[model samples]
Target: MKMKKILWFSILSLLLVIATGCEKEKRAKTKEEQIFPHNLEFAVFELTTHQACKVACGENGEILISLQDVKDDVDTNCSLAQFDSIQMMEQIKIYAYLNINGDSTRLEVPSKPCGTVSYYCKDKSEEVQDVFRLIDEIRDAPAAQGDSAWFFDTFERLFGKGASIDHTPYRIYLAKADPTKFDAPHARLEDYRLIFILTTK
Candidate 1:
């Protein structure tokens, strides 16, 4: 009877140690994610005009996607919101990151034009010009898990076929009502100099 009790105790202790180790690993990973979010090295940009967009992940200084509003077919009718429920594109662009899965938080005001920004460009197909208006200053932002497919999916749905969906995904988390704007969300065209900093404050 004493032997049986000792054996049971030993097994229980081993299980507790294993469980503790697993829990510790999870905490460490979560901390890492929170600390460093944006992957600047693999960052990509899409030049949007006439309500169209694209993604170019690997080609540095190359504008991968160029969306054009051909046929003038886009307006109130046959819009993105009309396709199933893809309301994320607008929110993502405005918010800097799409929250595919997160709690419903407060909605902030849409950013207005604050000031002008300049970009020194070289080694690209198109001329270098700052497309986005400066709303906030560029600073180091939190690491974000951006969805490359978020734009890719919408562009393909809007343009169809030849739409660009080829790029690496770096997740981003953005809010509607947040005060800080004009950073990543405000980035326009091919400005490799501008770096996105997701604000958590």
Candidate 2:
């Protein structure tokens, strides 16, 4: 009788191990299936608008998503504003401001070109910490020792400088560039995704 009991216990242990292995394999398969464009594997976050997001890309890229924006109830009241939520901010190319990280965390530095779009979170890592340090350096740096107006105009990009008037008689035009792109009268975060690509300099 004791022998039979021992045999039963061994069988149970083996079955438990097999089950655990299968579960792990299932998870591994799922991870493999989660493939993004350009063979990029990103760490995601739930971000917010007008909020500063500090992103870092190591061997494994990092990203912050404003899940809130996904469900944000946007309200806009403009004289002439009708922007296609599809082709604007969601999938625009970010060529110039690729390596900049500032005007978000520090109060001393004024935002240039464009303010950092960020959100709040509670995850910490060495890679992100390094980015913060770099931000400090950028903040302290002199303002290039010259007039910034001579440089390229971000006003056109951010505030829609030369907005095309649908009707010139009344100055009908699309909404100014802002974070409300994810809200209603534009696009919802549910159907579309605000993918912010992260790369290192």
Candidate 3:
């Protein structure tokens, strides 16, 4: 009977030790390293002829722009058409949690004048010149993750009227809908935001 007591005590002690070790391991983990509610943020800009409209992410991590008279389509071949006929442009900013699974945030702004492939139809020679000029401007801006080449390609495809877009260098991350679960494919992008920072300068 004494031996049985001793054996039971030993087993209980072993289980206690294993439980303590697991708790220690969990304490050593960091919340930042784990997927959570506040991991990432984003900002957006739109350049119009008269003034620029800016939107900053607030509590819900969203911003909306209201325009008086919005035109969906304009002449792609005319340089002045982009400015003369168009009434307004909208910009939106976003803030989100960066997670291991997929990208959660979004930017749905249409490709604007500067990043378009046609360069306002200013002839091939002048178009290249304008593109280079815009690229230089982006290089002069401040951004944590920006690239001129990304901007050039994004605009070329988006404004070039259904031109093929190469999404190889781009990456996507999903939102943490449930902290206990991780997903990868839930995140998506309407347009590339890399160019905004690349050509920000």
Candidate 4:
């Protein structure tokens, strides 16, 4: 009788361990499903300086950009213009996150600047001229009500009307931290640390 009772206890302990492990595995799978519902193709994020000026201007801030659901053809070698393609633009979604002094905010579908691809031109003269044109255009535009408004509206003027592009198959996004979203005073773009999260199809 004693031997039988000991055997039964051992079996029960083993069964409990197996059940717990199975439950844990089930929960992990569920969490993964929740995070990603669709097939992911590619994802990349980068931290770079937001070049506010053409020269060695010290007025630059750290910014993050993410490319998601991008086509296989596009890679680090591809210029921003290549990413500006309409087809890829429609398929991809970009996001930027900002953290300042512990406060964080998400810039959903952040605004992009016009003539983004011009920076990648091999011809230095042409690149400089195109960049100047973009700067002038932004300066001439009507004053925006806020930082967010200005950022979005400036890009909207160029992209909203279906601006033509020679490149195809990708879209690029530029993100900036909104001052109103955080409590920081006199906060410049350099004051915030940006993070980007990308998911590919």
Candidate 5:
């Protein structure tokens, strides 16, 4: 009877070990499947206007705009103003403003010949943090530095840049550029993205 009991105990232990090993292997495979390189997809939506982009990409080789959403419900009696905007590529080249840490790039803006799209970074790792930092920077930076005058002018020509129209609120997005989709190892994603904003007069 004692010998029989010992044999049963050994078999149970072996069965338990085999079951545990199989579980671990399954988990490992799941992790491997989700390990998609740095590439990710994002979307941007404007709450007030109901305008949204399915996908936004980065210009040059630097950064891409992925997810942008605005949920502000504040009431404002503002009118839309027209703008005359130049092509983003014509006005500037795409460039990334990286944070102190190499792990993340905060924002991607066009490198204009005469203007600077200044940005601030709250946290160098997270995407939402970077967006808030960018807003803070825009609020603090000098108007001349980020003057989208040409863009406004072009918009005005197309839509009417006067002060009587209702001004539309806008939002921006950022995403990780996919090397596989672009197929350029060194491509500074300057074209496959949603660029800057064009507001009215």
Candidate 6:
């Protein structure tokens, strides 16, 4: 009788453990599916600014934007703007708006050129020539210091001298829909737009 009771207790304990393990696994799988549905990876976009000019000049510099995939689990309620990153799952399209003399004009910036090159002038470890080589391929004019330089210079060359340098230049907008589906001018998605107040020296 004693042996039978001990055996029954052991079996019950084993069943409880198995049940708990299965429950935990089910919960984890549900959470994982919620975060990365359809086996698609999610990425966070970052805009890193490098000061090309002296400290006294303020925020006058180059902007290197990068998109990195998120490895860790994220909160379900968290939005892309909350992390100061663009959400890739929504097919976000970035638009460049150049503000000249209180007038805003949308520039024809190809999506391919937008994130191709990210370089820092001060980073001595990276080959300077290699950086210039990459920039030269994408840019219309000669490679100027970095990406921001190329951007501002290109516009100025097209419009007129001092078109960007004389004033606060452009604003970057991120639309949450497909590039082809939505008209950037009509969309009122200001919450996702990041206004980069870039100036040239």
Q: CA lDDT of 115 in candidate 5?
A: 24
Model 2 C-alpha lDDT per residue in residues 111-168, reported as the tens digit of each score:
1122223222244333334333333333334541132231113322321221121212
Q: What local distance difference test score does each model get? A: 0.30, 0.32, 0.32, 0.36, 0.33, 0.33
Which candidate, 1 or 2, would have the higher TM-score against the true structure?
Answer: 1
The CA lDDT at 71 in model 3 is 23
> Whole-model lDDT, candidate 2?
0.32
Give one digit per residue, the lDDT tens place, for model 3 in 1-201. 999999999999999999999988776555423432122232323322222233444454323322211122322324333443334321111222121112243223333432233224335334434544544444344431234345445434333321111222222211101111012223333221122211111
User: Which has the greatest lDDT?
Assistant: 4
On the 0 to 100 scale, the lDDT of residue 66 in model 6 is 25
Candidate 4, residues 37-132, lDDT tens digits: the string is: 232221223343342211111135232322221111112222444655665654332233322222244223442322113234465335434544
Predicted candidate 5 versus true structure: per-residue lDDT over 112-142, tens digit per residue = 3212222223542343344334444443455
Alpha-carbon shift of residue 109 in model 6 (angstroms)? 11
lDDT of 3: 0.32
- Candidate no. 6 TM-score: 0.25
lDDT of 6 by residue, 22-120 (tens): 999999877756543123211212221221222123335443332111111111222323434444422332333332233334232222111222224
The TM-scores of all predictions, comma-separated, are 0.25, 0.21, 0.26, 0.26, 0.25, 0.25
Which residue runs of candidate 1 sit more than 4 Å off their true CA positions? 27-35, 41-56, 59-113, 116-201
Residue 69 lDDT (model 5): 22
